[model samples]
Target chain A: MLGGARSGKSRYAQARAEAIAGRHTLVATAEARDAEMRDRIARHRADRDQRWRTVEAPRDLAAAIDAANGADAVALVDCLTIWISNLMLAEADIDAATRDLCEAIQRFEGQLILVANEVGLGIVPDNALARRFRDEAGRANQAVAAAAQEVQMIFAGLPQRLK
Target chain B: MLGGARSGKSRYAQARAEAIAGRHTLVATAEARDAEMRDRIARHRADRDQRWRTVEAPRDLAAAIDAANGADAVALVDCLTIWISNLMLAEADIDAATRDLCEAIQRFEGQLILVANEVGLGIVPDNALARRFRDEAGRANQAVAAAAQEVQMIFAGLPQRLK
Candidate 1:
């Protein structure tokens, strides 16, 4: 699943996972780095039911997905863009991380849904860093969509199939 | 049609218009304010064959559309987001302009295709003006979409129908 901020991608992905009868794991990539992020993270958590088990993977998402993978498990990675930011801030290899993530998703035993932001539609950002981030995020989205069996873009709480 | 930057929306819109055997008008909302923008606009203009007639409508799009409308005319507004920015810079009434533009679209005697950007998917901007622009752009997209007979989103040269 992919969408803009407040486009209800998380809710849509959550509902998808909740529809399946089995274990649920939320591979959270958000770190409560600031008050805004903290509030956002808490709000998302509040939306999920008690059946969810969240594993924080601000980085090392492949390991997190591996740990969460189980027979009959439904795993929702409630975003990849944040994970990209985390990797950028940590000076990690993004392409390698994305490849590993794709491999992990392919290897997963259960259903996996990945949520990412589509951030390159606006006027180009002014700063070099923001421009770079936008490029990287877009690249990751395209790569992930290619790897996934189905890709949907959410806008105004509506899902449009992309793949 | 709506999409991110360089997402092939213009190409897709142009192709759609070209498919219809009729007169084509490109209702351009872009202004060559800088070298980059000038180059981009020139490139887009070069993509069209001699069959296309261009009208520069940085603002006052309804009038431009009305003027361009004719029998067997296929008019494409290759974008609303830039028009929104132009209106913002001019301190014009965005809501009112959007309403007028929609009415023009509804009344148009030609095949009309509108292009817009999905600008709200990224991390929130640090500046208030950008945030407002994002909000305004999103509002325009939803409103325009509601008025459109059909809607499609373009990504990486691919077209995905949304409605």
Candidate 2:
């Protein structure tokens, strides 16, 4: 699912993941690097409850998803943008990481729903890094969307299936 | 209609205005105070042909709308957030201005399409002024949406009617 910040993409994805009558795993990409982000992570954790087995993977998302694969299990990757950021911060090859992640999603023996933020809808960021991040996020979304069988966009707490 | 910045809200509004087989007047609220803004304004102006009689109204939107009112005219206010910002920077009474704007829309005889940016979707801003602006923008959107006969949200160039 694609959406802007606070557009209910995470909550809606959680609901969809919970509906599947099988093992559920949430691959969380956000790190509690700051107070505000910690608060957000805490709130999301509380919302998921014990039903979702959580995997903390700020990087190595493909490995995390590969490890969580199970028969009849459904894995929900909470977001991709943060993962991209983590890769960038660690000086990892973004193109390689994205490719591996897509491969993992395709090879996993269960359903997968990935969430990503649409950050390109605003004015171009003033700094070079932010602008590059925006461009990378857009490219990552296109790649994943092409690999997925269904794509959806969330707006104002409502879901619009695009494919 | 409302949307995120660069989400094509202005472009969509301009296309809609062009299609109206009547007098079309575009109320522009952005001032070209900087080089970047000047370029953006130039591009927008280039996209709009001579058919669109432009009214530059950084403030006093109600008066501009009242002036542009015509029997067979469709007046499109390119944006509302910029007007709100103008009001704030000038220390004008936001509530009073909003009321007057809504009253103008209610009293206008011609079709009106007002565009606004969704500014509350991101993380809580670090500063009080930005937070205040976000709150004010949200309140303005709600007030105008309540008065509008039809409300739409533009997402990735797709228009989704909300009301």
Candidate 3:
């Protein structure tokens, strides 16, 4: 599921994943780098309850997914946007990340639910750096959409199936 | 200027605009529809210190820019990714948004600073919608980078000039 901040996209995605899978594994991309983030993470964790086995993978998402793959497990990635931002800040190669992600998705043996933020409908940023980030995020979204079986956009606490 | 979450991207952009041109205008894409978001908007206003003019335009960014254009006023867009997400959720034409953003940049008459989140270089999303968003953000970044005079990536609260 994809949507703006606090759009209930994540909740919708989690509910969908829970309905489809017997065993749920949530791969979280967020890092508790600050108190506010830590609190937010805690709230999300509480919201998910104890049914999910959480894997915190701030980096090396492919490896985490590879390790978590199983016939009975449904893997749900809470977000990709934050992970992308982390890599960009780290000065990692975006193409490499794309390739790694695609490869991981191909190798996975079970159903997967990936969440991401849609980030390109706004005004053009003045600085080149922010602009580049937006462009890269857009590219990543397209590649995943091409591979995904279903595409949904969540807004105002509602889900609109796009693909 | 960069900061985590609410860290000073908008404030810095506004300050930069005020420094370059005494009178500054803000292009706000966030819709204040909920208490949380309303709080966010209020915080942004408080941070701006009353030196800047604000224009709340949730969509049709090009028209907003045109309406706010002036010879001596600097234009500052608080964000781009959120606007893009809004469009995606609304099923708005992504191509139109891209075209309009580029046109606005090409025709901008004064200094402008834009805020955006880098959303590529992360784990591949499992669903089609997320993948599409990542791809679109990437493409948008490339398009803007190709056209913009400068490009930068903000990481760890620091700016890295890419172009």
Best by TM-score: 2
Best by DockQ: 1
lDDT of each: 0.88, 0.85, 0.74
Task: Give Cα distance to truth, residue A152, candidate 3, Å.
Answer: 0.6
Q: Supply the TM-score for candidate 2.
A: 0.63
In the predicted model 2, the residue pairs found to clash are: A121-B5
Least accurate 10 contiguous residues by lDDT in model 2 chain B? B152-161
Better candidate number, 1 or 2, judged by DockQ: 1
Question: Which portions of model 2 miss their true places by more than 4 Å?
Answer: A4-115, A120-151, A155-158
Off by over 4 Å in 1: A1-117, A121-124, A132-160
Real contacts recovered, all predictions: 0.31, 0.09, 0.00
Candidate 2 falls in which docking quality class? incorrect
Clashes of 2: 1
* Candidate 3: count of backbone clashes, pairs at least 3 residues apart or interchain: 37
Q: Considering every candidate listed, which one attains the maximal lDDT?
A: 1
Deviation from native of the Cα of residue B133 in model 1, angstroms: 1.5
Give model 3 RMSD, 1 decimal: 16.7
Candidate 1 lDDT over residue span B70-137, tens digit each: 87889999889999999999999999999998899889887999999888767778899999999888
User: TM-score of model 3 relative to the true fold?
Assistant: 0.51
Supply DockQ values for each candidate. Answer: 0.21, 0.10, 0.03
